[model samples]
Target: MPTPAGADAARRYPVDPNSRLNVRSGPGTNYQLVRVLPYGASVPVNCQKPGETITGTYGTTDLWDNIANGQYVSDAFVYTGSDGYIAVRCS
Candidate 1:
């Protein structure tokens, strides 16, 4: 379905600036690594859901952002600008 005209989509940003962002099959480290995003890589957050807390160079948080179908990354690894929910919750 198409988004309604002028409907706001969540803003996207380059989540990392220094380290390579690890893309995973799921939200936790236990999940398999699927890809490695280079520094300043584009990581568009589709939506967010609560998952495993990861302590990376950024900080610690259990929040996970869905980048694609079945693909998730810990919010701690990405700089979402806002510390709280900035997008719609995943259904």
Candidate 2:
């Protein structure tokens, strides 16, 4: 089997201790809250995009399907405010 994109082999980014990380369905707050990621959670960020202003849509929509098996982060990457971050699976 081929190694998946943004798989466990990918480098994980540590959650900022000061930032209030919101776990959304998609890569925006418009998405539903799957869960709130606490500080220190190591999230796998496949690609980082520049900040862009867009209207909120579906809550917790599957956005990171291209990365893993789609089962991991159906709704992972999200844009919270001006900063962008990926949601990591908590152990």
Candidate 3:
């Protein structure tokens, strides 16, 4: 799907049970570790702040596989890769 217009577009990330993702310091796995998010968590794809990188595993590479947010729930998505994005479980 095409990205929406404006800053909100950048904040939004694709969410799917099969969509691989990583929980890191920044949006990409290149940063420090925070945790590994599994499937079933309420990922907040459209609520990231500016300049704050939502760290996560590569989702598609060995470097990413090393990172682990923790465990998977029922309402979580499986991060795949760059195509996949960072997400946070909602309360």
Instruction: Estimate candidate 1's alpha-carbon lDDT, on a 0 to 1 scale.
Output: 0.77
Global Cα lDDT for candidate 3: 0.35
Q: Return the TM-score for each candidate structure.
A: 0.79, 0.42, 0.31
- lDDT for 9 in candidate 2 is 46
> What does the lDDT come to for candidate 2?
0.41
- lDDT tens per residue, model 3, 1-91: 8766664323422345444444555434346656544554334243222232233332232212212233221112323334332443222
lDDT of each: 0.77, 0.41, 0.35
Sorted on TM-score, best first, the list reads 1, 2, 3
Q: Which parts of model 2 have CA positions greater than 4 angstroms off?
A: 1-9, 47-91
- Model 3 residue 59 lDDT? 27
lDDT of 1 by residue, 1-91 (tens): 9988645453465666887888888878889998888887767788888778788756788888888888888888778777767667777
- List where candidate 3 sits over 4 angstroms from the true fold: 1-14, 49-91
TM-score, cand. 3: 0.31
